[model samples]
Target chain A: MSATRRIRFTLNGQAAAAEIGTHETLVEVLRDRFALFGARESCSQGLCGCCTVLVDGHAVSGCLFLAAAADGVKIQTIEGLASGERLDPVQEAFLECGAFQCGFCTPGFILMTRQLLDENPAPSEDEIRHYLSGNLCRCGAYPEIIEAVKLASHKVKSRTPGGAAP
Target chain B: MTPFDLVEPPSLGEALKLLEPDDSAVRPLAGGTALMLLMKSGFFRPKRLVSLRAAGERLARIRIEPNGELRIGAMVRLAALEWAPEVRRDFPVIGHTLRTLANVRVRNVATLGGHLAHADPHSDLPPVLIALGACLVLAGPRGERAVPVEGFATGHYETVCKGDELIVEATIPPLGRRRAAYAKCTTRSADDWPALGIAVAWDDDGAIRSPRIVLGAATERPTRLKAAEALIAGRTLDGALLTRAGEAAAEEADVVADARGSVSYKKQLVKVYVARALRAAGAGPAAP
Candidate 1:
């Protein structure tokens, strides 16, 4: 069975193309074809959020996502979060809160937090915990991660026009 | 995962034509979450996959009919289904159950059809759907046929669907005056697969009538707790009645042991969660 496919998609706000085997997962393609290592695959299974990527503005496990399925979609990885030399607000909050110890799982946690804040700008502690439950940090930095999410929420709200009070 | 030919069929007719009726190696792919897991593990080596992602928007619409029946297209994502106002307003049990399913990312990609078609008995939706008397419309080369969700799965990872057939949509009847709830007992994390899952529903104007209790995850298939349903049929729910119903469910279910728990442990969970589900359903439908 020969199933090599060519897919074109918008990556990190730029149009890109890749010739991938039908069997190759999106994470594999992202790392191999585009040299984007921010979205690394730790747990090949979808249970771990280590491979989270945004497809059309929704989070999906890239390890389980077939590269051939990336055609005609807008994909965002952790690498796409920062512009030029400035870090996204979520990245700043994570660094300020010291949310990671090993940093292997940092990219995934940060990406998930970005989505969480996009959905709920002012999430309560319980809401934040519930949303981030899918992600796991082996360093056991959950307390700090929660703090980072709260900080990021505040940072995001402040950046919004006239909604800084939250 | 071995390399396999992938065909992106633009329509359901083209997708169905791509699938060989007797070839198990040729299969339809929807959402790709569940199948990707199988492919990664090498347990399933598909010769050809008919990708349904481009198979038209008719497979993605969620319509609430005038009769209040929910006609959910097979390809509707779980997260969309969870957040749909019509679902939360009419079928709150579905919304409540989905809130605790696998996780946000999986929910965003996994479709309702794949969830049922995969027939992973540990899933939360089947038992809940069985309790609500949901029906699946299976489209095949011949035509479409409707099957009740209760007997759709014959065993773990087994279903009545033929190799060539694809689930087109799921139709949930109007909840009307009945209240329903699903209770799952996860031995590990809160979002982990349940050691035991119990879904119960019935008419609740004054007395419980036509009570449907289905136990899942702890069993081979979604098993109806007929003895338990019969136990509480015409009675107003009270503590004593709830205990008796729970006991009946625990005795009637044919639970099997796995990583989730042992047979004895799951039997105990069955007793506890059955009562919890009935109590929750009796407390009245949840607020939107």
Candidate 2:
């Protein structure tokens, strides 16, 4: 055993720092140091997406990442999706559609969807299902979740004004 | 969870030095996808972890050599491969496999070397890499040496790599006109390791040259089905030939029973996926 190492990175939009052990997971660090409880720790084996987060704009499981690996990287947790109290369109759609049942898996679903839309603005139904395949909704709210993503796609496309529908 | 010292080595040289002692209580940490879970579950207890993150440059780049071989940095995440244009254009099969791998989140952090080194029977990389005739470049006190992917995994959760050696990159020979495909049978669309995976590739002239067939989650380590491959090599693929190849693969593989599927079911799946992959490799009719 050794003293914890100091790690520095960008969390959401702010500079973040934490002292963590070599074996500490990103989910543990995010939940403990920054108090971002949104990155849940369910099934810490990386089997479940309850610990999903965005690292450098790419979705990843926090439980599978070493805390030290986040050094100098840009991270976006569920809390980072909003800007000045305005929820991101995907978040709003999830809420409007009641896509979450237990809410325990909402953050992971939201983050996964954000990554999916960023890569493909208007993904097909099959693509949406494929991309969100890792984030398990044990409560079986899949239909609502798919509908919410479709609604969010429409909202994003319509707001582009003259942009073509994705 | 047990606490341990974290050392971020700035380069591969430094990382190897940290593991120089054959019995040193240190492990090289990659994506930590498997390592993290193992540690958390109390399966692995190392005194120190040499973080490979600082060796970032070594892991993020993909280069093609003048000899027409493709070199992938050991650290290249699975997601990066899925999104890389060159990989998609030249090695569409690689992208296809990555796309089906666990999930988007896992792909974002899981590194190629880590996955290969983990040597899990059900892992997605081994079968594909072996089929592509890929080789791994390892660096250590003994300097760099290349090992064929087929011989890299010695057994379940085991590899030929020495404790001090670090996998720096993987080299995949160009496919040129060869068409390739990968198919797997799993319980779910994501997060579950395959019950059985099959990879197939053939050379130009459509003669089924350089045929390599592999099966995962069926044995202690991902293995090549030489008997099945022998059935098609140097012969033009036809309906009867493809069926015979699939049967040979099923007979050659040592499939084990798991929760996802039974041994008998896996044997059937081996035949089905092998046939499908061969057909998908352009052995069958094309869309009208």
Candidate 3:
């Protein structure tokens, strides 16, 4: 075993710290230390996006990223997307569209959608499919997920002046 | 898991010191995408990992020099390059390849240097870099040296990069009037490495110049087809010429079987994609 190193970063709007092994991935750090169970570890490799999280406001795979590499960076899991009493528009859409079945892949999908909206507020069906390709839905809820993303895009657009239509 | 010490070098100099000849056990760690996967599979067992993220020298930046050459930092993320105005304007083919690399999430994390160093025959960057006639700047304990992209990778995951050296940047000469395109054959729209990829570029004079062709995932290392290039050089491209060049490329590439596709299937795809890329490059600029 190797000596653990100190890792410091902002987690879900709070300053967080952990002593992580060099080999420990961010997914392990989130699930094991910080207890952010929302970031699932389905594939453990990068193939499955179950461990996806937002780093510096961009979606990235937590499984392949070293915990130590995130030092001083801002990280957000699915748990961070919502306010104390309100759901993010993406979460609301997912719920309305029944975009998830097993719910294991929902967190990653939500985070990915958040990134998509950040970059392109109003994406077409093809654009949504292209952006969300990293997040796999083993339960085959893709059509519903696409619908949910469209719904969320509309919801987001209504709030912004001159936003692209759904 | 085999134990290894982790060293986070604060600067390139310190990283090079850690990677000195005496410490053959030290390996510079970049994005950790391929290295981590190889480690998980027990393919490599380095005693120490010198993290390059903090070294300041490994991050992304694109600047046009006084001579008009574009200097790209090796550590630049694929996603950043995809949106860079300079790259999109001058090298749209590179931008296209970046947009199609794996997926958005991977693009956000995979660095150019990491991708190049990984030297996976199936990777998208090698062939593109070769076509651009890019030069790699490497820093090591012995100091810095430059190597052309064409001769950079020796075989498989192997590279001319010494264990103590780190690829700092890649410099690309301006493409004044050359047209270029990259095409890949993959089963899915996302998250799939190309079974075969081809990048083609030609100079402005209506005559073929710098006819670079690289076939990925078809050999242990990305192989350049000089014979095919010779066949196309100084000649105007057409369907017949493209077919002959594709045939020559297929013959030059050492396609092999992997979990993704069969050897014959990959070779066929290489020929097809090469022809397609050539045709696309020959099509010239789009209407404004």
Candidate 4:
């Protein structure tokens, strides 16, 4: 394709199209084209997971991922985690546990916790710490975040049949 | 980041033809994690990037050959390596190395080929690959050639790979009776780039044989501690032998200082981590 090319993909479930530069990052495209602000870029480097997004059901750093690479993949973001009225179990757990103070990194932590629990229905404290180590919470609410992840695991397990949405 | 034309080649052959041996600005783009970082900071500017994402499944399969060697395609994501039953069952040391490599997000998107091709001295995988006696198959316009992982990287962020040559696959020999362990010291977070990395693999025939000790991160490149390996070879791995080997490794390594640590501190780290990794492998593979 040319320097700026059109790419078509499913964003948060709806089919979308955008003309993105080859150098444009997925985070820039989501925020600029889709007005999706949940995935904010804190550290341009992949070190801080604030710009975390799900590409084809796998978590990836939006900051490092090229927008051109998202052409045919299904993308999910923090904005898409909740349905019309119901919040995701992880989000509910985060709210109930007050897992964040500044809240700049809450969306990333919640999204990552969702992925972790999906892969591991029940993760030990050590596992939780290890999995979420990439996403930083400068507010220093790590203990409560761990508690929230555990609570979310229980809530997710106890949900009624078919309550889980893809 | 400057604008550039991104071309998606449908197959490995076409991708190679699209590459230019003399043009550094025209590069083959794999996972794009490391390259994106450099581009964002204005370290590198590119004219075109030949994306290999759609380049068929030939470079994405993890298959065990008839001879019991594991052939991992270059485009195989790091997460696939972590979750692959064959990798976890046979080469558990690789699994151990991936556990603390970056994080779930990076592993989900970053490819194994990019990790080695980047050749960052602080990377954790090259030393592990070298210790396992791995070989990388590089494909170019001329043909394909195999290079040992030890010599694949020449210096920090440098490799013997020509601009037109692309790594197609990495072949790791079956573990057999050899058990391996990798230990790294991260100065910041546990997942941060290592300050010192030590990987040891020895054929445990009830005693250490053909022991391979490789040191990384603390040195300019992944290097084999030949003196230490010779001393430990054909010897039983005991407490005293482990201590002496650690000292020998520290003395033999060409350690250089970086922001991560001072040269003296890394030498000490080499001493400690070498013994620690040897002890872990000395326990033997718990399963077999």
User: Candidate 3, clashing residue pairs?
Assistant: B121-B217
Which regions of candidate 2 deviate over 4 angstroms? Answer: B283-288
Task: Name the docking class for model 1.
Answer: medium
Model 2: residue B180 alpha-carbon error in angstroms:
0.9
* C-alpha lDDT (0 to 100) for residue A74 of candidate 4: 97
TM-score for each predicted model, relative to the true structure: 0.97, 0.95, 0.94, 0.97
Give the per-residue lDDT of model 4 (tens digit) for A1-166.
Answer: 3899999999989999999988999999999999999999999888889999999988899999999999988999999999978999999999999999999998889889989988998899999999998999898999999999999998998784654532
Q: B1-288 in candidate 1: lDDT tens per residue? A: 889999988999999999997887888888888899889998999999998887888789998999889999899999999999999888989989998999899999999999999999899999999999999999988999999999999998999999878999999999987889999989998768888889999977688888899998999998999999999999999999999999999998899999989999998999999999999998975322
Error of 3 at A51 (Å): 0.3
Could you give candidate 3's per-residue lDDT for residues B139-231 as a string of tens digits? 877788999988898888789998778899888887777777888877654668877788888785767887788776667777778889999
- Candidate 2 scores a chain A TM-score of 0.94
What pairs collide in candidate 4? Answer: none
Candidates 1 and 2 compared: the better one by lDDT is 1
Q: Which lDDT tens digits does candidate 4 get at residues B207-230?
A: 788889999888889999999999
**Chain B superposition TM-score per model:** 0.97, 0.94, 0.91, 0.98
Q: What is the DockQ of candidate 2?
A: 0.72
Every candidate's lDDT: 0.91, 0.84, 0.83, 0.91
DockQ of each candidate relative to the true complex: 0.80, 0.72, 0.61, 0.79
Candidate 1 colliding pairs: none
lDDT for model 3? 0.83
Ranking of all predicted structures according to lDDT, beginning with the best and ending with the worst: 1, 4, 2, 3
Docking tier of model 3: it is: medium
lDDT of 3 by residue, A68-93 (tens): 78999999999999998799989999
True contacts kept of 1: 0.89
